[model samples]
Target: MEYEMFIKKSSLQQKMLISFLCLIVIPLGVFGYISLSISKQTIEEQTITSNLKTLGLISEKLDIMASDLTAISNIYFSNEDLRKILMQPSVEKTYEERAKKEFLTKMIINFKYAYTWLEYYTSILGLNGFELHTFYDGRVEIDELKKEDWYQEAFRQNGSIIWVSDPSPKLARTVSEEHFVSAVRVLKDFESGAPLGLLMINVNESFLFQQYAEAMKDYDQLMLLDANGTIISTTQKSLLHQNIKDTKYYNQAKNGDRGSFKDEIDGKRMLVTYHNVKNTGWSIIAYTPFDKLFANIYRAELLIIIVFVIVLFLSILVSYFIANRLSVPIKRLYRSMQKVEMGDLSERTDVLGTDEIGELGRKFNRMVSRIEQLHDRVVAEQEMKRRSELQALQSQINTHFLYNTLASIRYMLLTQTAEKVDSVIVALVKLLKRTLTDENEYISVGEEIDNLRNYVYIQKARQDGKLEVEFQIDDRITHAQTLKLLLQPIVENAIFHGIEPKEGTGCISVKGWEEQESLMFEITDNGVGITKLETGGAADITEAILSRGSGMGLRNVNHRIVLHFGEEYGLKVFSQEGEGTKVILKLPKFVKTEELISL
Candidate 1:
């Protein structure tokens, strides 16, 4: 019934088509776009960052070159021969001319070595320009001493160790044909604190500009500037010496900040990054043409548009076929439900293909099976309820025996046999307690022993010691769990039927022990025992063994034992016509402390 309702409520065709579009087509489209966009941006950013790092390394190499020049100049200024020669008159310079030449030659050799080192370093670093200048007295010298603007500036600064000059023309015999941004420093006399000479080191402007041009290869324009915001070098040399105060990058660099920004340069939109060198106060600028930078993105967008149009058309065609494939199962299920609703219980959906629609078909089948099982269960429960009512009626009839026992106890009390009356009353009370309490059906062997003891005490008092009851209980079996009142009824039967009816002295014994994993309790007696006719015709005996009572003691105990401990653990009877009967109760050892509280 439920299966039919589910099939009626759901449209297999619509759900299958919708889920296919959502789970497959839409996700593929979205994922492709997202992956492409993220990957492109990541690649671009990584490229720009790599270029920035290369530029920084180039700047570091230039700073190192300037430091190297200063170190060489310091060595020259501290040379005792040079200092002595400088302090002497020009005529004395003639007398020590040989020593002076040797000393000067050595100094020149040292300078040559330093220049060679810088040359190799610069070459490897992809840089150029390795010029060294020296100031003597009031003049500067490259290969020969001559006064120059930068040299004069350094001599005037005296104590200043380093200075970066604006872009300047290259001196012929010194740094080849390329112009350079130069660093100048004044060498000081160590003892007299006088200016010895000024040293200048020029870094190749062409090479530096080339790096900037490479960095912005995909851009239209790129420029570099000095501290004064003057364009020192550019890809186009014509832009050199131009003051770019109005430029966004220049204004930012002038303020001693470094960052990238977007702006219009000569009517072209550009993304630019400016960085300032601290020691030189020079700014390295990189500009990327915005249109070129996003060229790939534009191309991708165009491709996506084209592909989307094609996919849209393809989807229209595919959706129709998909809809057809999905609708077949749905239409079949719908018709099946319609048949089921009209009192057809055997209707089933026949769906093929391994997809969501197929899964729905399998689920519908399972639902039908469960509904049939539930109907069967309902009928079985109704039958069980009827049987239970009948059993309750049988239990009501069994209560009369209990009432008769209570009447016997009343008679004994009235007769004033005080001891006998007390014993019977106690026994009757215990029996009633066991019968009425339904808290828990299972109990421990120790509890069963205690119950049997009470029964024995009452029976001994009634027999007046004519019969002696013995118990052989293994201590280990005391903790084993068994049905409550399991052993008491069996003991009662032994005493009343097996022992009490005998003419002479009789003995009844109750023994409990564990064998392997099982607990066994036996009730045995030495008496006239049961007659062949009585044993064979004993319907009550068979009932007791089967856990079905005839309103007798052993039968009820067997019933409760089987109910709690299972059929195998209920009761077993072994008897001989002239000897005693032994009834054995078998149960598994399941001792739970919780059973104590219920008792």
Candidate 2:
């Protein structure tokens, strides 16, 4: 009934449809949405990273150019002849003055030949008012130039080189029309540390950036901005020397060393990438339109959307057909199951195809056939076993013992108190019912010990409470199995042969425990023990053995234990003349539930 209710709650077709929606269709839809959403952002990030690499390459080239110009200035500062000329005393007609001019002119000519990139270079002396250059011949007084900001800036540099994009008045006089960038340093005497002069190396700005500007024209504007947000050089000539201090890009670029972001530039959505030049506080920036970057991504997203719609439509149709195909076979199998449950085992499922469903159908038919055959065989066998068990039960219980128990109960009713009579009768009736019934062939050690206890109660009554019995059974072994009435006989022998015949007070103790997968019961008594035999053995042992009858004796109990469990398990006896006797019983510990026998 419970199984039928579960089948009605969710049929096979509904279950299969739900599985497709959750495991296949829904996952595919979710994956398509996630990929499309992240693809445009990922492309923009990759473009920014590529632009940073290009900026890094440009920065490296500019650094090398600056380093080479500084190295050339260092060469002239170390010249001994140039140092001597700058350190000479100012005299109108000195003998060393004429020769110094000739040497200085040759040094300037040599510099021009060695470095063709240098448009011109000038050296001005601070001590003597004299200036020498590649194109100029005169004394340009340092006192006049020292007042200018560019000159003061160089002087303040303290002999270190400084690159300045703004030219000084003296420089404008030499190349007034051409835009130039200059590296200037205040020269000093190597030995005396006195001020020798100022040296300047100037390069053409347009010539230096011509190639980079041409290459960057295919993209948006590329510019190098200075520390004050001024565009020092750019592909757009109009932007040169323009300060962008008020612009959003300037604020953003100045805050970080290098990064990229999206913002509107003059009503156009632009992706801007910027990086700071090392040691110069200048930034290289590129502005490109966002629409151009995401064009390909938009096209791909459209294609994915169309494909997703087609797949979703086809999935509904396919799931319906697949679920129907499987459910038809499963429905037939369920019907056959219901027939088998109602005892109509001849029902079989018709095989539809050679797929998994067909294979399951074949297995189901075979199982039903096997169950039907086993059912008939089981019924017949159970009837035969029942008769055998009845015959065995009849043989197991002795009628003579029952008659003696009834007669003893009658005498108890006449001579004993009513309370005593009722207790004895109840214990006797319980013992007879347990031994006569064939419900359980094997019983727990504790139950058998309980039945033996009832027998002890009857014996104690006969002896007028002279017999005292002690029971010591381990709790772990009590749940284990033993044959019914196994311990009672050994306990009876302890009382009759060992304790009852003694003159003084006698005590019998029954102990039960487990060892090495075997149950052990020991019955010990302090009574007149067995005497020694005449023929080199225990005395009157055969008579003592004969005293116990066929059903209730140590030998009979031992034989039954050996027959049920093996010959290795039985009884062992130890006795002396007057001290005590101990009988040990051993049997294999069988659990009733795990070792159930049909008989």
Candidate 3:
């Protein structure tokens, strides 16, 4: 209401000033505020998504690595030669019996070095209590490995593989200072289900960091935490193996939320994002200072505000000057119009100059002089439109009559018989006479189907009784009015493309029903389907008529249906290779009325 009052009270010049100011000032203010809000959020979200994507890739890589290790372990477990050598009693072997042992040693070494990620491997056999190591001293007893934490916990899993991170004493014998991520699996006999031994594959910790080093450059800190919230991997090496369950964003990540937040961590305000690595049940967390992440948002807002103030002042001054220049001329023209409305034809504005206002005055005077000329042309155009409509109606009637007469003649010539030919002649005569007399665009569905049946009878004789046709029209839609001649062309196309191309007997079925306030027609045929002629899409009827091997009758029929009704009431085709074709016709379910019949 307040806005309506302002619109009423404001003059053209004043309103122009207000509207111009609003168009510039309001949008500028809104865009500035929205940009400031969106910029920070967009940047933060992009950072989080980037980190999450990197971590997800690393987790997948880890899974693949674990799979490779398990595959290698399965290889050794199934090695019967190694199993037999390990199970043999020491008293039954000597220096000459070391062939299997030497070959097994070389095989493990080749397996370890073949995979770039595999740093070391160990197999602790429980049969004869012999320990085989890829990079460690090969003489270690199996009883010694039982003392390790990873070995004890792995056996507790009962044959399943387990991942143990940052193992003590490492696995690279020469570099005990370096930490490793180990996969431990217990091997069992394939047939006996008896525990054979334990197999371990150790991957260097530095190799995991190398995979995501480029992505970690943007953050001040990065940590990969296990399900227990213990730091398994970190850029800050000192924090490795430390518990992070007390961290501010740890629980949110564990709870499956991936986003950034501003919070104080270890005495500094930081923006942090954490995402869970689904395969490993570990969280990858990235942190940067709050000021560092959103510094651009603050600077952008300040710059936008400064520019907005200057532009607002300039817009007000320019709009007021331009509005006054334009509105003054219009106001003078309004006064002259008032004089002319009072029957003063001689009245004219003396404030005319060589501008748009002067041209408007000149055109206004000329328009009055030519008013009668325009009226005469309008009447002439109306007469032309009426004649064109009448010509169109006459042409449709003549075309239908000519087709029926020609079809009747063709049927007579093909049969070479004058006896018992009166039925075809009588149907053609009635069809031609009816088409010549009726000018209505729409006819009852039953009448159209009857005319179609007559046409089909003639076509059957022309095709030498090769066409098999059936109609399953619903009684509910028999009284509904539809555009005339809608079904004949579709049925003809089905006969030529669908029926004629097949070897054995082909069938054409026409079905009609009412569906969703529309009249639906389905013309289906079992023949060498339309797929051989063209692909399955609505064939452009106009183009199809000109292109050889394209369906001919389909385009003409679709064209007439669209002309009488509209685009929404036309043909849709479905065909399959070597199966069949179905063409559907849609039209409005309108009942015949006196008004429509007269049109």
Candidate 4:
């Protein structure tokens, strides 16, 4: 059978159940394989890295020990008895004999005591061997006696220490059976800077090999090489002292690289990691049997394959049932959409299953219902907006009438013979307009000034010029926007509540200027002044505007200004009892819409 037919031959319900089972099973299989591989690699790499760090720490501790021995030797070499013995030759026979005997006795006792200290530190640092040597009169001797190439090399290198050298003959007669890898140094006089002798330390090769054996316990083979790529040590002694030119590890270590590779060693297939110690010029190598590292991974892969085959077989049996169940509702919904397209808005699919397809059908039906309701709400909102616009227009028309009346009264006073009659009419016009005009909603500083001028003229006329009105305005701020009739209310309050209630003619001044980016308008009246109102009632206006809502004209002006320009531009009233009243209007400097659009 074709693959597609094979997949579709099962029942819908069975297909769904098989698919869900496979979805869960496949990832588990993949995750097991990946996790195993990564974990094995990480552990192996960390093991090797940790070993390298430990070796580096060991090498550093050895260096410090060598330095300490050198320091002690210098102190002993500088002792007055030893120095005097060395400076006097054997020709001064009697003095030389006595000095040499005393010097030898002192040196032996001091060295033995120093050796105790050295042994303690080396033991703590896990050092394998330590030695001190002295070279005098062209002869090299260690512990008052000695042997071979390391000593010769030390003298040839002009008293400089040889930190690392290959396996060589044992220095002390006591250690004659074994060879050693050694570090050696020379002692020098502190003040004269003259060479004294050599200090040598040798480590047994077998001890290091034992450490390598433990570190690579699971591995098939391991080796260590010196700077020249020659095998210095190995887990198996047969490979020790072997040259790298004869082995694969030699060519590999020459690269100074750390990595894994496949090779045949001792007739067994192996995987190896090679790393170099940059400070000591030694390379550490580890090898494992190829089968051991990957054995579990291969077995897991086989198990996954078996599980996949079993699942695949079961999947074929169930595909048809699952496909049919899933497709049915979708087909029903498609039919409903066709009905909807045909203008049958009431059409909806029957949902019998409790899956995503069922949920989708329910949501589609709800969406259609919401759209119909939203259509009705949109129609109603448009009707409400029409009524609100009409109300706004009527308010604007009423404000226009007040503006015309004030203009007419101003014109009559300017032109007619009955000036006093014209003045009374203008005062009445300004009082009515300031109290009722909605044009104050949004106006410029220039327009607000005109309103205030009409208001002050009316107030002075009412008091029969008992109040002298002074106006000072900055020309620079004239075009800035502010609420119209803002000053008229404050001026009226001052005259009626503060000035007229007293006996004498009073001074009333209105001034406006720009302070930084804000336009500040101040109205000060020094009439009778407001003794009672100045003390605490000055702040009452804001509370009255917010709570009692009595002073509608002042409240309206305050609210409109704040709504347009933010609360920072609202009115503030200040007064001192029996002193004067100051009302400050803080407004933002903003250009008119007509001027901005024209620009």
Task: Provide the TM-score for each candidate, comma-separated.
Answer: 0.40, 0.42, 0.43, 0.37
What order do candidates take by TM-score, descending? Answer: 3, 2, 1, 4
lDDT of 4 by residue, 1-599 (tens): 69678678854555576676667566766877787778668756765566455444444444455565556545554466554444444332376465565556556556646666344111000011122223212222243322455556666776554644453433423222243355555545557766555544444566556445555655666676666666666767776666676576557645644555667877877766667655455677677776776667667668777876786666554554566667677768888888877656677678646788888889888876776677669769856754454344335325544565556556556664587657657666654555454433456787778766766665555455588888899999887876555676677677776787778888888999999788898888875554432234453344533344345545655665675567667776566656667777887777765542322
- Point to the candidate with the largest lDDT: 2
In model 1, the runs with Cα more than 4 Å from the true position are 1-40, 84-106, 120-156, 164-174, 206-224, 231-235, 254-258, 316-599
What tens-digit string does per-residue lDDT give for candidate 2 at 416-491? 8999978888887777777665466678888988888988887776666689999999999988887777777677
TM-score, candidate number 3: 0.43
lDDT of each residue in 54-154, candidate 1, tens digit only:
55764566566556656665665566765554544434235465466555655656665767645311100000111222211121124232345555566
Range of the 10 consecutive residues with the lowest summed lDDT in candidate 3: 540-549
Better of 1 and 4 by lDDT: 1
Error of 3 at 36 (Å): 0.9
Clashing residue pair totals per candidate (backbone < 3 A)? 0, 3, 1, 12
Candidate 1 lDDT at 380 equals 100
Which segments of model 4 are wrong by more than 4 Å?
1-288, 291-417, 423-440, 529-553, 593-599
The worst-scoring run of ten residues by lDDT in candidate 1 lies at 120-129
